[model samples]
Target: MFRAARPFIFRLDAERAHWLTVHALANAPWAAGWAADPVDDPVTLMGLRFRNRVGLAAGMDKDGIALEGWQRLGFGFAEIGTVTPRAQPGNPKPRIFRDVGSEAIINRLGFNNGGVDACVQRVARHRAKGMLVGINIGRNKDTSPEQAVDDYRYGFEAVYPVADYITINISSPNTPGLRDLQAEAALDGLLGALADTRARLADAKSVHRPVLLKIAPDLDDAGIRSAAAIALKHGIDGFIATNTTIARPPGLSAKVSGEAGGLSGPPLAEKARHVLRTLRAECGTSVPLIGVGGIDSPEAAKARIADGADLLQLYTGLVYHGPGLVSRLARAVSTS
Candidate 1:
């Protein structure tokens, strides 16, 4: 059904189709059951319990303003926002792309959002459904690397109450020097400072919400080691395994090859798995890792479990496959 509807949607802008899908799913009476049953992907991560392991990734809900619809999709959990402290229109239009043949997407969205305050109020309104809601936090484009910690602190404090767990997104290549925060010295300081804030928030609230770090897929061996080590040192609760890659890789060098954006979907699957395995091995068997990037099927989600991911998330794959993809993935995992 979604494939038949794709032509009309494909004609519209990517962002508009995204909102249209959100509204459609929200109104569909059967979407809740359609997206959420037959629990094969049951879950627990970072001391928090998720009803399932499948989740929507950060970019899907950039403002936390789209929860009512997402919760109905039957995701064991849903993460909203790579929200910044304040609102800013991201990069220019045509920043998002679709590679139909690969069932993938490439985007340079640049963290455009309605800001933390608005997102907090909106997310708080629909958080009643019991599904885990994660808020992905990021620094605004204008924030210098030196001031990044304060930006993260602002977002963490503001969005903390409404989220089940919070994800720190420092790996996006589009942001100026943002991924540089992943370095050994920078990661140490950033994670250490973030941990202090997380501890304070946990103490005051009398609740321990996990703080998970999302990393880039392009890191070299040393970078991964340093990142994993710093995460442990700072008491970071979990890891998102990866964000997007800056490297185009051998598979995706098409005519759209030079397009400046993060490439995701099929071509990214293998490397994403490798990174998940690396993080899992580094963090040891006990540390929780949520895998993301290029999850297109129940098989891929299952591959994640096999690769040592405690859970999984999707964005690009969902766009190409449409609404039914969630149920397909959920059912597949349930049977596995």
Candidate 2:
């Protein structure tokens, strides 16, 4: 179905098609529990039980609005948002682009979304029917570094009830001073508050949902190691192997390379795996890792598991390869 419709979808601006795709999928009968049955792998990681191994990455659904639609598409899990404390229009139009030849994308979408209150209501009303769900949280674009912890805390507290797991987004190169939070002191402060918030929210007769940190692919060895250590010290639940990369490694044409944004898709596979392996070794096997970045095929998904990613995510791959990507990845992970 997607293969046949690809040309039409491709003809519209990337952002418009993205919303149209969401609405179309949401209205499809297959989005409900009875229609789209879960894949059989039954992955259990970070205290959440997912029906399949493939997850829709953070950026795809920047607000909670698309969960029902993404759910209909057969994903084992769908992560929505990089949602901020307050609403804001993202970067100007033309912020998202496709690199057709490279099977990649360059996006500088600066965490656009309605505020936490509106997002929570939207997800509560129209969330995915039966798949695992994660909410990725971020600070407002103008939120100062000194007040970053408060922003993450507000997001954590707001989404805690609705989310299956909460992903703290400190990566995205488009947000100024956002990556600065990755520094040792800044990360420690942020995670410490979030962990405390998690504890306060988990007193029920049930398990506490995991709180994962999404890191950047651009970090050096020292930075990666420091981030892992802070995660351990603060008892962070898991790690989203990477966000997106500002550095375009090699092999793409000069025109696409000149686009200023985080470059993702095939070129991100190896670097993401490197971060996954390193964090795995540092955090030990106990802390689960959900790998993202360049996971378009079964081979790439399997490679991520080999490199220590217990769960997986997809974005650009879905754009280039189409909707069947999740079912195909679930089969590969199950057989492996």
Candidate 3:
């Protein structure tokens, strides 16, 4: 069904088509039943049980509007947002571009979420049924670098009770200076603040939740090790490697490839894989890792598992391979 609709959907503007799809699923979650049922290869990590290994990456559902829809679509887990403390309109128009020939997308959407309060409310209503749901949090674009930790703290507190896990998203290239948080000094401060906050919250709330860090694929060898070291130092729960890439690969000839933003899709597979491998080597299996990049096929998914990813996520893969890819990957990695 997705294959048949792909042509018509592709004809529309990339972002428009995205909303149409999101809203459709939002209104009629049963629509997800068209895809195969999710596999039952349970895994326990970070003290949370996941029905399967494949998850919907953060950017796909910026708002928590379609949690049930994603569950019905056969994802074992779904991550929503790069949500901010306060609502913001995000970057200018024409921020999302699609390159069909290259099977890639360049987006500078700048987090454009409905704030943590709104997202938390939506998440509270879902009741989670069978899917493990995570909320990805980020600071508002206008928040200065100095005050970033406060914004993240606000987000963490707002979403903590309702979220099964929380992802600290500092890797998006579209957000100005967001990546700087990955630096050793800045990261230590940010994660240290959150670690302290989490300790307090865990005591007050009577429950402990895992916090994962999402990093960009553009980081160099030294940078990757530094980020991993800091994450471990702060007792961070896990790592999602990675978000997206800014460097264009050799053969990407699509016109939009030149667009200034983070690129995701087939072209990103190698770079993302490298980061995942590097993180695993640095962290040495002590921390769990979630691999997200160009996993559009069963082979790519299996490769991620072989490379030490405890789980896998899909975004651009769904764009190119359709919803059924979720179940296929779950089955592929379930036994691997």
Candidate 4:
């Protein structure tokens, strides 16, 4: 069905087409039946059971309006948001661009989300449905870097009760100075603050939810090591191998290749995989890792597992391959 609709969907603006698909899944009841159940490749990591290894990565459903739709579409888990404490319009128009031939997308969409509070309300409605959901939280654009921890803490406190796990997203290149939080001292401060907050919340709520860090692919070797070390020091639960890349690899459509933003898809596979391998090596088997970026096929999925990823995620791949990739990937990783 996606193959048939590709031409028309591609004709529309990339961001518009994306929201249309998200809205359709949210509003169209019949869209729930669009996929078959993914193979049962249960993964027990960070004390949570994932029905399968395949997850819808954070950027795809920032506000998570289609929780039921994601579950029905066969994603074992869906990481929603890069959500901010307060709602923001995000970057200006033409923020998302696609290179259909290369199956790549460059997005400078920023963290355009409907604030953590509203997102929590939407997620609360479907929190009991049993799908593992991770809410990815971020600091708002207007928030100064010095006070980033406060924004993250607010988002953390807001979604702590509902999120199966929480991902601290400081990797998106589109957000100005956002990735700067990955710096050793800044990361230490942020993680330290959140760690203390989590201890309090866990004791108060009497429930513990895993907290994962999502890092950018642009980090250098030294940077990756520092981030991993800090996270381990704070007892962070897991790591999402990479976010999008600012570096434009060769062969992308020249028209959009130079666009200022983060690039995802096949161009990102190598770098993302490298980061995954590095994290696996640095953190060893103790830290669970979620591999994403340019994973458009079963082979890529298998490769990620071999590279030491405990789970896998998809975003740009779905834009090109459609929902069927979920089940296919789940099956591929089930036995690995």
Candidate 5:
């Protein structure tokens, strides 16, 4: 059905097509039926039991608009947000561009979201249905980099009660000065404060939720090692390596290739896999890893696992291949 509809959907603006798909899934009575029975491959990581290893990545459902819908779509889990503390308009129009030839997307959407409070309410309404949901949190665009720790802490507190895991997103290229948090000194301080906050939250709530750091794919080898060291030192439960890349791959169309924002899709697979392998090597089996980038097929999904990703996520791949991709990858992982 998605393959048949893609031509028409792809005609619309990339962002518009995305929301249309989300709304359709959210509203469709038959949406759950669209997914095949999920492959039964359970794994315990970060103290949570995931029904399967294939998950829908953060950017696909930013506002938690389709929490139940994702589970029905056969995903083992779904991550929502990159949401800020307060609502913001994000970047101007045409922030999302599709590079059809490359099977990639360039998004400068700038963390546009309806704020943490709105998403919290949404999650509260649907969380009881028993979906394993991860909340990905970020600072507002206007929030200063120096004061970013406060935003992360606030996000952590707001979503702690409901989240299966919390992802601290400091890697998006669209937000100015956001990546600065990845620096050695900056990362240490920010994560230390967050760790302290997590301990307090856990104590008060009597529930210890896993915390994962999402890093950019643009990091060098030394940078990856340094980030892993910081994650270990701060007791981060896991790592999502990585976010989209700022560097455009060779042979991309100049028209969309030059557009400013993070590039995600097939072009990002190699770098993302490399980073995952490096993180796995550095952190060993103790620290879990969720790999996302250019995974669109069963083989790609299996390869990510081989490269040390304990779990996998998809966004652009879903756009190109449709919801069936989730079940296919889940089955592939299970049989492998």
Candidate 6:
């Protein structure tokens, strides 16, 4: 059904098509039945039991609007948001462009969301559904680099109760100065604040939800080492080794490739895998790593696991291949 409908969906604007798909899943009474149940292959990471290792990445369901839908679609877990403490409209229209030829997407949508309060409420309402949900939190666009930690702190506190885990997203290229949080001093300060806040939250709530740091794919070896060291020093629980890349790959459409945004899909696989491998080497076995970037096939999924990913995530893959890709990858991982 999705295969048949994708052509029509793809005909719409990229962002519009995304919203349409999410809305349909959220509203469809039969959406779950449409997807085959994923193979049962459980893995425990962050002390949480995932039914499988193939997770829906953060950017796909940014507002937690379709949590149950993703689980029903065969994902082991679904990460929602890159949400902010306060709501803000993202970049101007046409912020999302599809590179059909490259089977990729370039998006500068920013972290446009309905704010933490709204997202928290949504999670609270759906937490009983039994799907593992991770909330990816970021600062509002207007928030300055110096004040960024406060926004993340607020986001942590707001979603702590309902979120299965929390992700501190500091790598998005759309927000001005957001990537500055990845710098040594700035990252150290942010993670230190987050660690203190997490400890306090754990003490008060009697629950310790793991916090993962999401970094950009544009980093070099030194940068990767610096970030990994900072994460380890602060006792950060894990790392999502990449977000999206600011650099365009060679031979992409000269027209759409020049757009200003993060590029994702096949072009990101090599760089993302390299970063994951480097992080795995640096962090060793102590910290968990969620590999995400251009995984569109069962072979690519297997490759990510081989490259030292404890788990895997997909956004652009789902955009290109439809939901069936989740079950296929899950089965492949389970049997492997």
Taking the candidates one at a time, how many backbone clashes does each contain? 2, 1, 0, 0, 0, 0
| 132-239 per-residue lDDT for model 1 (tens digits) | 788999999998878999999999999878888888998887888998899889888888888888889889988888888998889887788789888888888778
Minimal lDDT window, size 10, model 3 = 123-132
What do the candidate models score in CA lDDT, each in turn? Answer: 0.81, 0.83, 0.91, 0.92, 0.90, 0.90
Which portions of model 5 miss their true places by more than 4 Å?
none
Candidate 6 residues lying further than 4 Å off, grouped into runs, are: none
Candidate 2 lDDT tens digits, 105-153: 8999898887888878877776446667789999998988888899999
Backbone clashes in candidate 4 total 0
Instruction: Give the per-residue Cα lDDT of candidate 6 at 52.
Output: 92
Worst 10 residues of 5 by lDDT: 29-38
Candidates 2 and 6 compared by lDDT, better number: 6
How accurate locally is residue 6 in candidate 2, as Cα lDDT from 0 to 100? 84
Backbone clash pairs for candidate 5 read none
Whose lDDT is higher: candidate 4's or candidate 5's?
4
Best by lDDT: 4
lDDT by residue for model 6 over 192-281, one digit each (tens)? 999999999999999989889999999999999999999888888899978999998895799999899999999999999999999999
State the TM-score for model 5: 0.98
1 or 5, greater by lDDT: 5
- Every model: Cα RMSD to truth: 2.0, 2.3, 1.0, 1.0, 1.2, 1.1
TM-score: the better of candidates 1 and 6: 6
lDDT of 4: 0.92
Let me know the TM-score candidate 4 reaches against the reference structure.
0.98
